[model samples]
Target: MTWLVTGGAGYIGAHVVRALAAAGIDPVVIDDLSSGHASFVPEGVPFVEGTILDQALVEDTLRTHGVEGVIHVAGFKYAGVSVQRPLHTYEQNVEGTRVVLAAMAAAGVTNIVFSSSAAVYGTPDVPLVTEDLPKRPASPYGESKLIGEWMLRDQGVATAGSSQPLRHTSLRYFNVVGSSDTSIYDSSPHNLFPLVFEALLAGNTPKIFGDDYDTPDGTNVRDYVHVGDIAAAHVVAAQRLAAGEQVEPAYNLGSQNGLSVREIMDAMARVTGIAFEPEISPRRPGDPDRIVATGELAARDLDWANRFSVDDMVRSGWEARRAAG
Candidate 1:
């Protein structure tokens, strides 16, 4: 009856575990502690430290834990860096997913809630990206994620006649920020909130990648959802899948009402009381001017929404960052 959460010691995965715990559901964790902290796994929660690439270990963990479902969140998740390390990214995200799926099949665990990304849209033209948008992943990381979704879909097709055809859903999100748990902080060098917080904490000027983009502000505009909300949606999806209820193949957990980079800087100044302006830097290659998705479908199903405002998002991450310091 327990749910196995892969990468449950990582920031977002830890939040998902907390959400599942709050729902009175038992969560067993399988984390390799690659970028995750062992301490983040809740005290007394069943934890097995191993990579998803180990199919035997994954299968054993599922069988040993009597897991009814899995929330797969373990993978290499740096889109920008993936361009430079395509092979590593593919091995971790694609191959790791393959191993997890194989283990699930072997263990007869037929339900899974995948931790997906909006990077699959890859410079989408639509102002409001949706579940129906054609996936055109730009980087290897995004490509790997799309392939993971395909794996789930094809598996569902292949096992349709089985007693337990895999019931699964992938939640695609962009720019997850803020923190509900001060103990679990975002340490990703590639993420915006941590990058800015680190720069300010070091008494260095935070630099904006570009300020010449064609947006309301001079910088890019994208959906920045709170981590807590993201975790909540995952729990909801898992519950639905485990209940054998029909769910969409994929859902995008994003904000129709997103913020611009400049607007975020303004919030940072207000929240952290840091008055210095961010340094302007050259645009990173393949940087889009704006990329925000509408979560109407997720809202209908997963209780998704932008419950936290820009100020709330900024303050939450700032508080966690300061606490970590």
Candidate 2:
């Protein structure tokens, strides 16, 4: 059965598409091209360029492609930008997900793998967060995602008695970095990896937003997982759902290891052989001091393993960025 991958032409979405292709499954793509690149989509896979907000378009694509499952990844994803454009974030993330679910119910598609975020956990006092942690999003973007999850949960409950009920697995990710290929490396200016890479390419020092965090290095710490590994988890989730196995509404995907901002910078310097210092500033509002995940559930359930280290993530991103130049 074919799968529908929203935002399939984007960085993480493109990697998921590639993983699906590698598994000998040809998934169809629907993207509005607002943030995704057309070139990133693999050849021979059917692609429909449009917004998820367009319910008719989404339903038509699903029906035309005979899609049995969906991997939803289309949405606005910048945490800092979401603080400024709360309305836009809600519309794209929450409302857009609602539209997709409505279309899925209309088209009789039952299985889905949602791309959620660790931001839903907000700034918990605990260092390593688990799937069961309390969700208290600090930003509009995070709240939007939590709302999307609620939509799925509520919808699932409403359709429980239906012959074909919607079965979904929402994967909450923390700092998805690196690239599946050079053509689809992150184009967003907001993410740390891309921002630093762009600054270094322009012969400028990358700026660190905060240096007074309680972390050991006096910088923010995050769980940086490889994009390829994230893609693999989606694949496994899709397969499990299709196999008629019982699945939960959400799971956390992360490295289970925290990497400090300074550590990332040092790794980049080591990989690219460039010696440059980052300009430190006060911590941005809504920014968490540390956000790491306990990915044990994903590892046990999906057989997911992060093969790339911090150095590998940096070097792969460097290669992809240089190739894009």
Q: Tell me the whole-model lDDT of each prediction, alpha carbons only.
A: 0.92, 0.90
Across 1-325, the per-residue lDDT of candidate 2 in tens digits comes to 7899999989999999999988877799999999999998988989999999999999999999889899999999998899999999999999999999999999999988999999898888888898898999989999999999999898888888989888988999888888768777988878889999988888999878899888898998999999989999999999998888877688888777889999999998899999998888777876778888988888888877889989999988888888987
Give model 2's TM-score versus the native structure: 0.97
Q: RMSD in angstroms, all models? A: 0.9, 1.2
lDDT of 1 at 292: 91
Error of 1 at 254 (Å): 0.9
Q: All candidates' TM-scores?
A: 0.98, 0.97
Global Cα lDDT for candidate 2 = 0.90
- In candidate 1, stretches whose alpha carbon ends up further than 4 angstroms from where it belongs are none
Clashes of each: 0, 0
> Could you tell me the lDDT of residue 291 within candidate 2?
83
